[model samples]
Target: MNASDRTPADLLRSALAADPARPLVTFYDDATGERVELSVATFANWVAKTANLLQGDLAAAPGDRLALLLPAHWQSAVWLLAASSVGVTVEVGGDPADADLVVSGPDTLEAARACSGERVALALRPLGGRFPQPPAGFADYAVEVPGQGDRFAPYAPVDPDAPALAVGGLELTGVQLVGRARADAAELGLAPGSRLLSGRAYDSWDGLSAGLFAPLVAGGSVVLCRNLGELSQEGLDKRVESERVTNTAV
Candidate 1:
């Protein structure tokens, strides 16, 4: 099958169809200081709604760029999928001015987008705590309103062969990523309903796809450390014990 024929959304959708009430992501953002989670069904709706909101709010044209400052993980996953579904390019900013649209993360959004200078037309950022105090000109992505549509339609049918990501200027195909994620899940031994503890950064491709998306799609549990970079062994131990998590091969 072609790359467009498969995607993380496919796996997520399957899981939601099987059981929408199940939690697809569980994590605490260090910047937000709030523990949040989204059940499979809620996540699906969130993705669709976000797609509609992004499309409407940004007026993103087909193949337009939406630079993502958010790291990879559960929350990032939904945004990535939503952006893809709506035909907006998901650009993880490695260099400033590399994107047409720029959205910054709690820690790095401001500096990251600063590289863009005046190149970026639309800047979407979350509000509240560390929501990057933009210097004069920038819009809050979180403030963007979700459109009236209850669902989203693909702006253009995504070809599995189309580049899903850019790494140092090289395009990575969507199908390749899906395959890699699946393979990693199998190698890690994750299956439906498995419990996982990750004190790792989801910014990396491997970590985001395998550590977060893989387990969630497989009907598993994901426990993320809010301070992943500073996570202590003791903290992970406590989380395991308190949560009654059973370790598996994955």
Candidate 2:
């Protein structure tokens, strides 16, 4: 099979084997004013745990919709990894109404459900939001959710053309998104161990699949910016000059 034919599981298995401990994903945490680095192995484990929780605990059915309204933190990465672990397709958006389950920040929960999540709860929130500045009523995900499952179960490989994510009527399925990611990685020359300076937003058109998932599933490091303004002309120049970022799909 061609690179485009590689499944998310295929890509993930490769990344974990190559350098599971290597910094695969980074997030700028607004609450702590710091960068949170998640190693691929640990992230993979979390993904497994999350997939199990969603499947066994939450009783999430295959092909059922999940909404991730998580803050732009490391947990957002967890949601992505977990969703991929299961064959469950996720509909990440500001709206929870479109989703059967919703995971969001303490403050964002109400809006998350109103938009698409059915009966919003705290299970889908980031761990950081719990401690110092927990949103009013929500409990810590660890505290509220209590247990985290061990491993992810096997599911049939999703159809390439099955609808994976949607915006209005526009939809991209698992196989379709992975195909595009591989194409982006190749067309952009994303090599293993390459660092990407991404100034885009996950909610934006390009950032979601291309800036983030494409490089990641391709085995590249992504330096995410919480704000585009932070990647100022000077900052961009410095990152490119100093970090030697091979590509900027932002």
Give the winner by TM-score: 2
For candidate 1, write residues 193-231 as lDDT tens digits: 776666555556655655565575456766665555454
Off by over 4 Å in 2: 1-6, 29-32, 115-140, 144-146, 155-161, 167-169, 231-244
Q: Mark the regions of model 1 whose C-alpha exceeds 4 Å error after superposition.
A: 1-5, 30-33, 72-74, 112-135, 146-148, 167-170, 229-232, 244-250
Clashing pairs in 1: 3-160, 4-160, 97-116, 124-141, 125-141, 188-250, 193-219
User: What is candidate 2's CA lDDT for residue 133?
Assistant: 49
**Worst 10 contiguous positions by lDDT, candidate 1:** 119-128
How many Å off is the CA of 116 in candidate 1?
Answer: 6.7
Q: Please give, for residues 70-169, the per-residue lDDT of candidate 2 as tens digits.
A: 5445566666656666666666663566677766655576676354323333433244334454444333455533367555666555554665665334
Q: What is the lDDT of residue 105 in candidate 1?
A: 56
What is the lDDT for 69 in model 1?
A: 69
Task: Report RMSD for candidate 1.
Answer: 4.2
